[model samples]
Target: MTTLFELFSRQHVYMQEESAPGFAPACLMRVNPDDWGRIAEAARTENCRWVAAWGEDRGDELSVNACFEKEGAYAIARTGVPRAKPVLPSHSPYYAAADRPERHIRDMFGIAFTGHPDTRRWTRHQAWKEGEHPLRREFPADGHPPVPTAPDEHYPFLHAQGGGVYEIPVGPVHAGIIEPGHFRFQAVGETILNLEERLGYTHKGIEKIAEGRDAMALARLAGRVSGDSTVAHAWAACQAMEKAAGMEIPERAEFLRAIMAERERIANHLGDIGAICNDVSFTFAFYQFGRLREVWQRVNHEAYGHRFMMDCIIPGGVTSDMGDQVTVAMEKQITFLRTELEGLYNIIDDLPSLEDRLDTTGYLNPDTARAFGALGYVGRASGMAFDVRKDSPYAPYNRFSMEVPVYQQGDVATRVKVRAEEILASCFLMEKLIDELPAGQIRRDWRIPPSGAEGLGFTEGFRGEIMTYVRFGDNGRIARFFPRDPSWLTWPTLEKCIRDNIVPDFPVCNKSINGSYSGHDL
Candidate 1:
């Protein structure tokens, strides 16, 4: 298998180069700015997908990078904007996934994506003054006066002028203890005509805090980007840091990281499957899955330090170490889990009502899934065979044998089944890692390399592939760090999936395809 770096190196040598201000490789290939349009066309033609688009502030300017992926590799296309006027073309017309990130960059850096469908504010609020951009280096966080709020303005959505069309607006503050995000549903009675999501009410400016921070500190912040994804994000950030520092983790440490990651996956999947069932009014499934998830998290806290395993991953290696005794206990737990899972599957499969609620609800057809660039169960359910652990094969994943489960239904049922199968698969994989149990030190000192080198890291988080790119400053601080959560892709798919579904089924559909609000808000 070839490394992403190797692929980029080959492409760099063959492609034409052009310079942009404040960017590392001033002379990057100058595809026609319209080339973005062409690239989108090619991805559709060749059956590929867009992942993310984010900007890194370079003091004097901003450099935006958009990534697209195929089966074996991915390409990052860069577009630079001068610090004076951070403006660029919009790809939302072609790929719907570009909508949020472009809005986010606009919110944080004041960069504008011209021709974007909706050019409204995302993360910025009345906290900052009219001329202020909180994330910019020039904007100070100290002693700022509270700004006045503008009179509420109407959000103009696309017109659905049919006789039966009506609008339904749901929460910025929810009934449950979830994050704030508004969902605007345009529907004809029960059937949805269109869905527009408004998120970023909880934006924490994680990227702003990341600037100038040391690698070790950044790992802590990265882990907290989304509490549920603590292990994955931290692992990605650490992988990038280790690469930039020219350090390799010990073989034993790598295996431990993988173990932590697989465990994280199991915990989340169990909770989600149960929650989805609850949304469909399947109390038995919900209770069983919730009880199982509680056990899973409790085990994590017992073995590691936190229930969510927050701070369990560090720059050089994992913070928690599993001894033989813990390994034995885990083996026994796995045995019990496997048997319980089989029984649960039999129960779920026997219920025709459960299948009816899930089988075709919130369906994202294959073409739509590809165009929207969905990942994880959303993509896998639509017949996309992309799994970072299987395709990219990072850390101990490369050391083990595995299979990526996929289905072609692209509905709520398919998503649930994919998650369930993956949980079982991860249990088996973790057992293998624990059984072979490498004997060695689990932690090592990471040396910070002299400045100017950049590093890229990718991990298959429980949700999907989470990516981080970092370029170190002259003082070994983070000059530029961009982390893309899988939610960036999955969120757009949610909007697409809700189309044509009954208004009442929105709860089950939304739960089945749960995208992180906090992670995306960052």
Candidate 2:
């Protein structure tokens, strides 16, 4: 396979000699706005995955950056357009995953992707005036006071017009305590023909609020990007910051961080498996898994001081450390979890009715999974074998062996099975990390780098890959920060997977995917 750098060099794309500062192995290059589409096309031809795209508001022009990955190497391509008329060709033609992100950029920074098939307003659904862009430097971090705006009743949703096709609109406000997102489904009788999602309702302007925050403050904010994935997001952001500052944390901190991440992965998978079962009315599995999760999190609080492990990871290193007793307890919990999980799995496998409900429902083909660049269990269940820990090992991961579970069925059963397998794999990793606990300092004094330095960081969150980009300005403050949660990619795939399934089965299909609404909204 051709390397990322060579692939772009073959296209005669002008790349900067000095690579961007990041823990992740990547290079930065400048591309002309006119050549953006060509660059994207080249990447697609080489089978490179589109990572993320975001816009920065420079003083005179709007700068757009697109990231791609191939063979464990990353390429970040940048281009600028005049701020007055921020128009450029779209990459959505080459990578279907780029469609919504480009629309998000257009919504936040007023950049126009001229050839985009859908010019609909994505993130900005009457949140601001017609001409106001929140991410621009001129826009205030604290916006003007709230004003009464009309309901989004006029927004256009695609109509599936036929003899018996009718539309069913689900909630922007749900009955349970969950973030709001509107889902429109066109169905003929009980089977869904198409599903479209409108999902900016939970937007909190996280990107705008991140400007000028000190290193510590920014790390806290990154932890909250999506509450459930706190450890992964904070680590990604801190990795970016530490790399930009040319700082390496102590070896002991690295081990502790990995332990937290694996525990987080296990806890979330347990909750998700239980929730998916509950959606299908398998209450026994739901209650059992929920009980296990509650105990797991309670142990987390006993060991790490926070049930969710929030604010435990800071810029230089982790804020919390484990003692000898805590390590022993954690090891014991891992053993207990494994034994219980195996017994539960055997019981679940024996149930023919449960198997009947899950066998072929909500199938997502590998082709669609690849086209959308899906991640985590969503992609793994569909036969995409990309895992950051195994593919691009970092720190503690580099020191240990990793195993990734993959399935080709791409159905609800396959997805559930993948999660169960991952939980076991994480238990194995946690055992290794705890047994090899190092004796050393957990953190080092932070050193500030020069202004205008940029870095990128990524980690495999429970849902999938989490990528963060950070640029430091004068006074060591964050000039620009963007966190690409895995949900952004997985959410679109959910819409595709739900088609042809009966409306009653939609809950199970959706619970199987479990894309984060807050993470995507940001």
Candidate 3:
């Protein structure tokens, strides 16, 4: 396989070695603002997936970053644009995943993407005045208190014109307890012509809060990025911090970390399975799966003092250890849950009515999935075979066997089947992890590196690959923090999959993709 350095070097980027240890184990380069799009297109043509793109406000220039991955290798192409004229060529024309983040960067840093297709504001939507980038160094975290926020009813949505087309607008608020997001659908009768999503309703200014935070404080904040994804997000943040400081955690802690991630994965898959079933009016299946999920969460609570395994994963190491009895009990619980889950899945799979509802509903083709760089179950169901655990192993994953389930139907049924298969795979992984549970200390002290330390953390959470970037300031405080959640990419595909599908079936389709509103909004 060709290396990342070879790919970028071929594109005439000025290659540079990053001094911060363990940030991203790949070649780094600084590119000219004009060649940013060219360099990005080269990597995309070479089959590299788009990871993330963001902008940092330097005093004199804006640092624009486009992160890409291929063959388990990552490359970061950054360029410094003069602050007075903050303009960079857009990477979105080649990578659809770059579209939202580029708009986000434009909204947050006032850096214009010269050739970006969509120049509309994304993250800021009237919260801040025109041309005021909240992420800039000059913008105070606690800005002057403003007047009551005005209602945003006049968003210019792209309306479809047809013989019988009509518009159906859904939530910035919902009847359910789930988070807020607005959806605009153009449909004729029940057939949808187009679906547009208006997210960022749950935007919490997470990156803004990370400014000047100590390591521990940042960890706490990262853990809450999405409550269900606490373990994965916190782990990614800690990995970045530890790597920057050149700290190595213990083997036992690594094993426990794996256990926490797997548990988090299993819990979410369980809940998602039930939620998906419930959306189809399969009430019995929902109840049964709900019971199984409740039992599974209770086990996590008994084992780690929290149902979702939140805050159990700390920076440098895990906060708790599994005693011998607890280990044995967890092993048994895994077997029981797996068997029960299989039985529950068999019922859903065998039921023709359930199958009819999900089989071809919300089909996302392989071509679309490829173009969007979809991740997690959404990508897997559509035949995209990139899994962070197997593709780019870290900790216990590199030391064990991994099986990533892939399906080609790109339908709701396929998505459901993939989740079912992943639940089984996670069970096997957990058993192996417990069987080889290493014996050693669980905590390590990480020293603060000098100012300007930077690091990157990449991991496969339940939803999919999560990448976090961290750079430190003086006194070990966080300077720049960005969490590129899988939801960021997956949310876009939700619109594509629903195309040409009936409006009423949108709920099941929505549940199948199940993008995290909070994670993406942040």
TM-score of 1: 0.91
Rank candidates by lDDT, best first: 2, 3, 1
Compared with the true structure, all predictions reach lDDT values of 0.78, 0.90, 0.87
lDDT tens per residue, model 2, 21-43: 66347877788888888889889
At residue 75, candidate 1 shows an lDDT of 61
Candidate 2, residue 118: how far the Cα is off, in Å:
0.6
Clashing pairs in 2: none
Which regions of candidate 1 deviate over 4 angstroms?
A: 1-48, 125-131, 141-153
TM-score of each: 0.91, 0.98, 0.98
Task: Write the number of the candidate with greater TM-score, choosing between 1 and 2.
Answer: 2
User: By the lDDT metric, which is better: model 1 or model 3?
Assistant: 3
Tens-digit lDDT string for candidate 3 (128-151): 788688899999886545786566
